[model samples]
Target: MGSVDLIASLNARGPTSGFTDVPDNDESLPDDFQREKAKLFNPLKVGAFNLRHRIVHAALGRSRSAFATESPLAAEYFRQRTTPGSLVISQATSEIVRTSVLNIRKAAENEGRDQNHIKIIASSTTIVAATDEEAFKKRGEYLSYVD
Candidate 1:
């Protein structure tokens, strides 16, 4: 019979560590926690706007932009997430008409395409979840630090 090893590992296919190494009465983490608050939670004044929080919700999806025609849905989408003071950017929308924007080759091929028929750019940086938005901005800051 094989002998069993008594040394248990939390992440090694065993139970997780029951508790943190820090004492139950620990206060150090509490004090340090605020220092690490996300910029999304902080307040900032961008131009004429005095954002409630520095958290800028960058371009998301068409839901936050002109819905097919830059409708109120786009404005509502942004309004839903933004505070009175904060700024909410709508999705990166096209500034020009479809007929004028598409190149000759592509335009000729898709000239009769309806607005709804246009493809959504899935690879667009806009449109992110709350967590993703936070992490995305953080990563941007991190990358800039090295540059």
Candidate 2:
């Protein structure tokens, strides 16, 4: 049914509808108490990956690595946040590679459980310039290495 129709049907049910056993507008509990209790904490299939929880932890770039490769510290950092069933989004520079992804995944694996349960997403940002010349200049500056 449409949203309006659904709302009308819900409203028609009044405080106690057959839809749920919990009381409607019960002041005894907090606003979200019933809703939170009803939520499923079970594993769910998201696309091809099975997540343990619905919570997602997005990693912020902290300048942990100076090279294109994922540093040991970065791997451990990402792994520590990979709670069961939760997704971890790791932010890195443009030079992120396959090994970095694998390292993060490996670190997230827990004992007696498959490592694939914890999903890891790698994200990067691209620099944009107003003009072609500016873009090239920016790219050149980014690619240049200083020792």
Report clash pairs, candidate 1: 42-54, 51-85, 60-127, 66-70
User: What lDDT does the true structure give each of the candidates?
Assistant: 0.46, 0.55
**Candidate 2 minimal-lDDT segment of 10 residues:** 7-16
Per-candidate TM equals: 0.32, 0.36
lDDT per residue as tens, model 1, 39-104: 544668776777765545565445334444555655555555554564665443445333344654
Candidate 1: list runs displaced more than 4 Å: 1-32, 35-40, 63-73, 92-147
Q: How does residue 147 of candidate 2 score in lDDT?
A: 30
Q: For this target, which candidate reaches the highest lDDT against the unseen true structure?
A: 2
TM-score of 1: 0.32
Off by over 4 Å in 2: 1-31, 35-43, 64-76, 98-130, 133-147
lDDT of 2 by residue, 1-147 (tens): 443443334333333243344344432333444433433434678988898545455564355567545677667656655545557876555445577766666776635456777666654547799998999899888868523
Clashing pairs in 2: 52-85, 53-85
